[model samples]
Target chain A: MSNNEHVKVPANLMRRFADDPEQADLEVFGRRSDGDRRGFLRGAGLATMGAMLGAAIPFNRNMPAGFVPEALAQKAMTVDGKDGLTVLNDRPVNAETPPHLLDDDVTPTARHFIRNNGIPPENTSADGWSLTVDGLVNNPMTLSIADLKSKFEVVTERLVVECGGNGRAFFDPPAKGNQWSLGAVACSEWTGVRYSDVLKAAGVKDNVIYTAHVGADSHLSGKDGKLAISRGVPIEKAMNPHNLIAFAMNGKELHPMNGAPLRLVVPGWPGSCSQKWLKRVWLRDVVHDGPKMTGKAYRVPKYPVEAGQKVPKGDFEIIQAMPVKSLITTPQTGIKMSGRSMKVGGHAWAGDGKVSKVDVSIDFGATWQSADLSDPANPYAWQRFGAGITFPMAGYYEVWARATDSEGRSQPFGIAWNPKGYLNNSMHRISVYVS
Target chain B: MMQRLLPHLFVLVLLGAILLAPGRPAWADEDELGGIPRAPGAEETYYLCSACHSFRLVAQQGLSYESWKETLVWMIEEQDMSTPEPEERELITKYLAKFYGRDRLARKLAKQQ
Candidate 1:
C-alpha cells in the first residue's frame, strides 16, 4: 500500500432499509469529508486519478455556470414534514409499490419504491445543481456542494434502486408509463463520489464508448413524463468499481422523493438510468442511445406477451436488469396474516444474476418449498427470504415466493404482459392468517 | 404529486377496459347523461372535479360502473373527457359523491338525483 495508497469505502451500510435521509442530490453527491480522506478511486488504478484535471470549472473559470452550493438551499415539503401518507406523493412513477411481498428486508420508507421521470423536485435545493464531468475526461469538473465534499474521496454502497418504471406499469399496451407497483423499488445506503472516484478525478480521454446519466427531473413529458428521461451507461457501467456519486440515503439526507443532493447507485441497475435529480456525467464518443437511451422509451416487444398486451409503439429495449424477485413484508393490504404458523418474508434479486433458489408457494402456483435464504452480504444485495408455513386447515392461504437465479431466471408465470409493465418475474402472491 | 397520479390512472385505464371489453353497460349513456356531477362530496368534489381532470383524476377514483365507462373512455379517448356534454355527466356524477359514489345505486341516486 505505498505510492500514495487509497482504499477506504467504509461506514453506515443498511439496517432494515437503513435510517433514511440524504436525497435531493445528497448534498450534490457529497458533504461530510474530513482528513485522512484519500478516496479518489483508492489509489488511481484507472490510471493516476485527476479527471482531466477536474475538467476545469471551479466556480466560473471564464463562465460555465450552474453549480449550486449555499447549504443546498430549500426542498423538504413532506415525506413527513406534516400529514404525510400522500402514498409517497400520490401515484404515477409506478402507481406506488405493489408487487408481491410480505417483507423483503425493509422497504417501508412509506412502502419505499417510487420511479420518478419528471415532477419530484418539490420546494427544491442543492441550490440549483451542477456536476458536468464531460466526455473522455481530462479534468472537466463543475463541482459545488462545497466542491464535491471539498474536492473528493468518499464512497458508501448498500445499493438497490430499481425503476425502469419498476415493473413498467405491468406492460402490454399498458406500457405507456408509470403505474409502478412493487413500490418502484428501494434499498438505500448510497453515500458518494466513486464513479471511479469521479472517473479518476477526471482524466480518461481515449475513444470513449458510452456514459451519460443526466437528470434534474423536469423536461416534463407526462403520460407520466413520457420516457427517455436520459440514460446511457456502458463505460463498463461507466467506469464501474461500483458506480456511486450518491451523497446519502439511509444515513439521513436524501429526500426530494429520494434523488436529492445527487444519485446514481447502479448496484443491480434499472432505476430509470439511476439518474434522479443527478446533474451530469457525459463522456459518450460513439455508443450513446439517448431517447433516454435507444430512443423514445424502455422498449420490450422483441417478443412475449399475454398478461395484458398493449406494447405497440415501436416495440422495446431500453429497460434492463430486473428479474428474479420476491416480496410479502407484512399483511397490510386489507390485513389478515397473523394466524397460520405463517412467518414468510421477502426481498430477492437476479437480473444481473445470482439468487439461486427461493420457491415457497401455498396455492396459486401450487406446491413448492425451499424458502430460508437471507444470504446477500452484497453480490448486488437484496436477499433476506424466510418461511414457516403452518395453517394446514384454517382458511386463507395464497402465499408465494419463486426466485431461482444463477441465471436460470425463474419466478415467471407473469412478466410478459408488456404494455409497459416491464420485467415482472412473477410468483409473489400473499394472503395468510387463520385462527 | 402530478395531481395524485391522475386517479390511479383512471383506475388503471378502467382496470384495463374491464379486462378487455367484456360487457358494455360501462355506465350506459345514450347520452341521457343526467345532471353530470354524478356524485360529488367534499369541497364540491374539489371544486367540481378540478373543472375536469385534476381533482387528481377526480381524487383517485374507485370506479366500477363497469370501470366507470372504461374509465370514462380512457378519459374521453386519452383524457379529454368530452361527449356526455350538456351537464357533463351531471357534473361528474354530482362530483362523484364522496369519492366515485361507491354504488348502492350510487348512494341512492346521490340523494334522490
Candidate 2:
C-alpha cells in the first residue's frame, strides 16, 4: 500500500482490541496479519493515536467502530481564535493571514497574523499582572495594568508590526523557523503609553545601551527554566516615542493570542522585537545578549552569501529596520475579472522610513504604472496605495505591486539568499483570470 | 430480555460518564509520533526529537545531511538537548536526510535556474 493510504481504525475499536486481541478480528484493520495487528497495537495504542490526531477527539465515544474522525481525515487545519489564517505550525501556533483578508485599512484583530515562537502563557489575567522595568535603571519599577493607565499618558496610534521572517517561505532553500508567506504583517491601532515615557519614569541609567524584553510564553521544549525567545532592540530604537507599551489592539482589549493585557509595539522593526505577554524589560549596559539575541536568530549575514552556503556566526548582523514591501490586497488572487478596468489597491510599508512611491505591473514587471500612495497615519503605520489597471486584453494576468522607500530602495525581484532566511521583501504578485 | 437490557444500560452510563468528562480524555497523554511515515529509523528519530518538541517540528524541515547534523549539534549545544549516542545520531540524521531532503520544490526551482 502507498504511504498515504493508511488504514484508519476508530478509537473505540482500537481500545477493544487492546483489551482483547483474540476477540478482535484482524480483518477490520485491512490486510494486516495477526502478528502485525499485535505489533501495531503495542507500538501505537489509543493514547499514541490521540497525539497523532493533534487535538482531542471530543466525541470519540459516540463514533462508530469503523468511523474515522473528520479531524484525522481533513488536511487543512484552522486555529481556534484566528480567521482565514494558514496554520504553519499548530504546536507553537504560528499562523499567517491570507493577503485578501488583510484588505482592511486597520487590520481587524482576528485577521492579524500570529507568529509565536513558544506557547503563550496559560494564565493571561490582567488584574494582578504587572510589567517590571529593571537592570541598569536607577529607579526600577513594577507597574500593574491599572497603574500603567493612570500614571502615564495613554495614547493610541496605528502601527505596522511585521515578522522578520515574513516572506521566509519564498526562500529557495527554505528558512529554519516558521515559513510565513506575505501575511505575517498587520497595521493595527494600538492603545498604550509611550515606551520612552515609561522608561523615563523608571529612570534609565546612562550606561544602558540596549533593552532586553521578556515574556510569559513558555519554551517549546517543555523545559521549566528555558525561555522560548527573548529578543530586544537597541536603546535608541527603544527610546523612540512611537514605540508603545501596548495594552489594547484597535479599540478593544488585546486578543489572548496577540498578547492579552500587555505587549510592546516596537513598530517598523521585526514583530519579535515587539515582545508579547510582556513581563519585564531589562536595560543592558552592553548589547542585550538574551536568548535569540546573539548568533543568527533574527540576524542575517553581514554580507550577502550564496544560497546554501555556510557562514560563520561572527559574520552575521542583527536586522534592524525592515526593507520596503507592498501587497495587493484587492481583487484577491485567482479572482475572475469581470471588467477590463479594475481598481487595484494595497498597503505599502518601510521600516523606519516612508513609502515614497508604489508601482503596479499588469504585464509581469516588464512595464509598470505608478499607483497613488497615501501617507502613513503615524510614523510607523503602513501607507495605503491604489491604482486603476486597464488590462489591454484579458488573458491570464498577474498584478505585481512594488513599493520604494524614502531611501529609493524597492522590492527585489530575486531573494537575497541567507542561511536562515529573513527580510525577504520580494514584489507581491496576484493571479487574475480574465475572460 | 432484562439481562440484555442491563448490559446496554451499563454501556450507556459508561458512555455518558466519558462524554461528560471535564478536561481532556485519558487517551490524550499517549506518545504522539505525529503520524510520521514509518521508516527504518523513524521510531528512534521520533522518540529522541519529540522529547523536546513535536515531531512535526522535525518533519517540517527539508535539509541536507550535513545541515541535519548541524541542526542536531546545535540542538545539543545551544537548545539544551542532550547529545544522542553516535549510532543513534547517525541513524536519525540519515533518516531525516532521506525522507526530508533538500530536494524541496523551491530548491528544485533554484537548481533549474
Report model 1's TM-score to 2 decimal places: 0.30
Error of 2 at A411 (Å): 0.8
C-alpha lDDT values of all predictions: 0.52, 0.78
On the 0 to 100 scale, the lDDT of residue B51 in model 2 is 77
User: For residues B1-113, could you state the per-residue lDDT of candidate 2 as single tens digits?
Assistant: 99989977876665454444433333322223344444678778878877766565565566889889989988888787888889989999999898667774433432221
Q: List where candidate 2 sits over 4 angstroms from the true fold.
A: A1-76, B1-31, B105-113
- Cα lDDT of model 2 by residue, A1-435, tens digit: 112223232322333244333333222222122232322332223333333454333444343333333444454556666788866666677788888899999999988998888879998889899999999998999999999999999999999999998887777776676667789999999999999999999899898899999999988667897888899998999999999999999998898889987999999999999999999999998888878888789999988789978899999999999999999899798889768889899999999999999999999899999999998998989999999989888689989999999999999989998988899998999988888
lDDT of 1: 0.52
Residue A47 in model 2: shift from native, Å?
17
State what share of the real interface contacts each candidate retains.
0.00, 0.14
Candidate 1 residue A369 C-alpha distance from true site, Å: 16
